[model samples]
Target: MASSSAATRELQKELEGKANDLSKIQKDISKNHQVRKKYTIQLGENELVLKELDLLSEDANVYKLIGPVLVKQDLAEANANVRKRIEYISAELKRLDSTLQDMEEKQNSKKEAIYKLQQRIQSLQAGKAKA
Candidate 1:
């Protein structure tokens, strides 16, 4: 219906102030504005483009009618990728914490051993003085 690129110009013009009902319009402007030429064109005096609000999620708002195609995507796959990254980072942090704990225990033991040895040497010196 609104497939003609010409209507895109009209739609853009009309959608300017109606942002209350169209919350995703800001994102569309950011994501689609760059490739506007590739996706949009002038049909007579009207300019329009078929936009897939989100190619990766397709949780989209059809703003302009491009050529006759609706781009739908697999959101599950994207979500999986994010989850994997988070898990990897969390594991790495846990490993670092363990290593730090081990180092701290080793340092504590060394200090304690030095203190005990010093006490033994002091007692031996006092006995030699008495002799």
Candidate 2:
């Protein structure tokens, strides 16, 4: 009975540890989702800026907002900057997508492990009761 109790305690401890790890992973996933959302918004805004720049005449005045100040900028320069920003954001989104996929996979495996641990604990308890 003592041995059984010890085994049960060990299993319970392991389960708790796994639960903590799962929780941390879930939090990380949530943070990743938020970051990805922000980047997506930025990408959309940059694309819109690019489109507007395209519609403007070659000699159209362009100004960049710099900390509540509008600084004059060349139209070509503005277009290039916006395009670069869009490219960067798109790449970051792809990287985030890959990371998200990996995290989700890890999360799923952790969930499965936790479920198996619960089952094991239940079985152990049931066996102890029978004994």
On lDDT, the candidate that comes out on top is 2
**How many residue pairs clash in each candidate at the backbone level?**
7, 0
TM-score of decoy 2:
0.97
36-72, model 1: which lDDT tens digit per residue? 3332222211211112212334563333223796543
lDDT of 2 by residue, 1-131 (tens): 99988999999999999999999999999999999999999999998999999999999999999999999999999999999999999999999999999999999999999999999999999999999
TM-score of 1: 0.36
Tell me each candidate's TM-score: 0.36, 0.97
What lDDT score is found at residue 122 in candidate 1? 52
Best by TM-score: 2
Clash pairs of candidate 2? none
Cα-based RMSD of the predictions, in order? 32.4, 0.7
